[model samples]
Target: MKTAAIRALPASATVFPILFMISTVHLLNDSMQSTVTALFPVLRESQHLSYGQIGLIAFMMNITASFLQPLVGWFADKKPRPYILPIGVCFTLLGVVMLALAPSFAMILLSVTAIGVGSAVFHPESSRVAYLAAGSNRGLAQSIFQVGGNIGSSLGPVMTALIFIPLGQKGVLLFVIAAVAGIVLQTVVARWYAAVGAAPKPKKAVAHDEKSALKLSAGKVRMSVGILILLVFSKHVYLSSFTSFYSLYLIDDFGVGKQQAQWYLFAFLVASAAGTFIGGPLADRFGRRNIIWLSILGTAPFSIALPYADPFWSAVLCICAGFVLSSAFSIIVVYAQELLPGKIGLVSGLFFGLAFGLGGLGSALLGEIADHTSISTVMHICAYLPLLGIFTLLLPKDAELRGR
Candidate 1:
């Protein structure tokens, strides 16, 4: 029941600026990726991407982020992670610059790959740092951290549109400005971080016996991790696929206009933003096991509910469903980190990585279903994966979920 504060993860003032820098960078990278979704016709027609290829490019960052995030997290535990934040920003900046200047498909893919890899590198370290800065109020702090990403996703379309306005002159200049700002921020932050004797680590509630508890085999942890991966996959499909396409789907299928259809996305994100705060406390009070199981199971009825509703009410269904899907996100990371208290970085990365990287692949497949089948069909099919996560988590919670 004891909840004591950990030593400051960064300089007291530094935490806010670091979070600010990281959040802003996230905004830019996300805004830039909307390039594929918003400019689909232009990019697809000119470059001749297959339906699969287009989705792949859209989620390249997810795939790479999935693959590399755990390794980055693992290393962060052993060595200095201060530099990883701005370094991730640098990757996005470079990648975006390449995208703006891309002359061929190969170059475009390469640039997109950089963006993916870069995002992966930043997540574990950033999440860990965010965890520390949060101190005793993990739930509240993490929700704010998550909201930054939500804000970024929302900005994606808006920023893309703004940049697209002055396509030739302003777009190019805006990108240059983004890259330079990132580089400068990285430089300043790294210098400040270098003065530490020990690297950053979150303050644990109690120093649980590290060696005895770590005896849980990697195999067992991986299985739990695997279940989490399934959970995240479903999550990605619901968010990446549904969130990205519902506006279009509502318009195309329901004979709604783009402006009216956007209302669905707005409502859905609002619900989801609420869900993040809701899920965290539920996990802290009840167990992550029960909450996740119920949340995933809830997806089935909600998914089925959405397509059947009359147009007017369908937006309501999608909004509620989006919230159900999003509710688990931050809760899942907190759960995973608690389980593998042994490998916070690795756990953090894997929590985000599969969600980003492998989940990136899943997102595209969802997109393909959209391209060929129907968006509703894709959503319905994707809903089942969360139900599968129940088995993965059945073994028992790997870590405690005590709130201070």
Candidate 2:
């Protein structure tokens, strides 16, 4: 089955138009979804919600997306669904509308679940689209796709500060336009995919031999996959602390206003967006393992320093932490695709699912810790997570192992 799917596709010429189109839709879709997190402080004030409850809200949305994504990808891999993209954006549109009018916490959860479902549908298919459009430059293609989401994620806090915070939750309604735009854009992309998505043009004979040389035993492949999953776990757990609670941390520790804290979060995420672009081209040249190692582990010093720094230094360290860590994800995704050539959709889904799931669980658990102990303490504890990058030693070197 996998072999058939691989053979159906011919390698493509790098399709810049399709890549840019999908990335634009990604920016729109994620900007809507991330707007929820950006509004957390306001939601807490409006509802008198606890930190634990806030964490649960993130958990609810992410877990919903997490649980469904792998299944969606697995199904799509077996049967390509070119038109599913627009349908997913419709779910996001509905979710945004519901969130704007949400009367109670229960309604908010339901709204986020809709949003999550949309995300679950969106990521795998969109990633596969990036894969199809990549041609020979897979790493750069994934980075181009990913940077849009990072930039969108950064925009959430800014949007919240400028729009939602001022106009109240109803400001979320304006983003419905973005969702509608996404549906239109994705529909066009769907048509493109229907024409060319599965057809990878034949490579030159030497390239074919290189592909054959890259084969690995099932056991080694599985082990590499496990290592990648662990890397995801480490990355997201640390990030969950920031995305879910960094605003609160700034408020508690530095006496910053909520809006100000959001700006800081925006800065960190923007740095992340910058880092995402850098990682891909570097990995394309230097080796994915080297970039992965540096991205996951190299941030440890800054992560450790962030908790103790004064407000200015804290923001600076956070930016450094975000930039260094952010590079790993695109590297990880493209590397995994290289690892399992035919299972692009399934691999994308699984890794993206694990990222959401682990981040959700980490948020939930860390929120409880903050409720009982202190946000400062939680930050101190999470700083140790990137040290797990020591395990990157376990990943097989693709260049070295290609012909073994």
Candidate 3:
């Protein structure tokens, strides 16, 4: 019988090749997404747009992804479609082409929505792939997967400085190559996923995990999830301030040129990428709860000081804040997954969706604040957001999670 054959096949081991391939695709996917943010200054100048408009653009893209990712993940949990990987990249490809030629603000929104659709399909599915390929090293696997995204995100500032400033909105066309590469790489990954799917899942193990997950009362689980969501909201809203407005702040307050300002943002993002890479391994060695606690709370001092620092010190503070703050996200995702075992796709999708949604919402609100007040005020307000890390204390300890 097919079941007998599937059972006869050995259990899957850590699949590094698949993980790397998926990580590369994530880099490509996120780099393409980052192009939208990178285009902000060019668009603002060319269209004579306001801060609120800029925030709307970011919201359009990110909110679309936020709304759709959970659905994509839920569907995948029920019935995964391997070919969806390449299909998702096709959407991004179309978005890239449309973005390059978009003449009106409306067209830009439509184009970003397409890119958002692509991202929605890509993240949950690819995260599931990372989970499948992870075997026992889930933390390391997630870190590898997440570091690519942080690195890719860091490229936005670089692109703004190097490419978009010179090429204008048309520069977006260049990233079509990243989309094509993503498609090819995703195809390879899809095949491996398909092969993996042919193996029968360990239902008994899954049942055990499900039972273990339920050991906490429903109320306890709900409370835990609520706390995690709060943690995510706090982390992402703070990050949104940096991503959406930090460059403009530098330009307006510090007298830096727009292009020069991007370099500062780049430093912060690059530091974030480094932090993301280390956070997972550290969580694997230390407790996830400990790392999450340290990562989010530890950034408070630097973030609190950043608003008052001079240019040189501002950059240092931003870098420090970014490095420390970025470490918690991957660990948070991993912790959430452990909390609700067997719903990997759903949990990943929910957290990732919250991240994008909350960040987008924060950006939109903060942009309005910036338009009404000064960017400096925005920075000072966001500086205190990290203090919300105190809530992490409410989370159940790592040993409790493992024991359950």
**What TM-score do all the candidates reach, one by one?**
0.79, 0.94, 0.96
Candidate 1 vs candidate 3: the lDDT winner is 3
CA lDDT scores, all candidates in order: 0.63, 0.87, 0.88
Alpha-carbon runs more than 4 Å astray in model 3: 1-12, 197-200
Worst 10 residues of 1 by lDDT: 1-10
Which pairs clash (backbone N, Cα, C closer than 3 Å) in model 1?
61-116, 62-356, 62-357, 63-357, 66-353, 66-357
- For residues 55-104, could you state the per-residue lDDT of candidate 3 as single tens digits? 88888888998999989888888887889999999999999999989999
Off by over 4 Å in 1: 1-29, 33-36, 41-50, 160-222, 255-263, 285-287, 370-376, 389-404
Model 2, position 34, has a per-residue lDDT of: 92
Best by TM-score: 3
Worst ten in a row by lDDT for model 3: 1-10
Which wins on TM-score, candidate 2 or candidate 3?
A: 3
User: Cα lDDT for residue 401, model 2?
Assistant: 44
Give the best candidate by lDDT: 3
Error of 1 at 236 (Å): 1.7
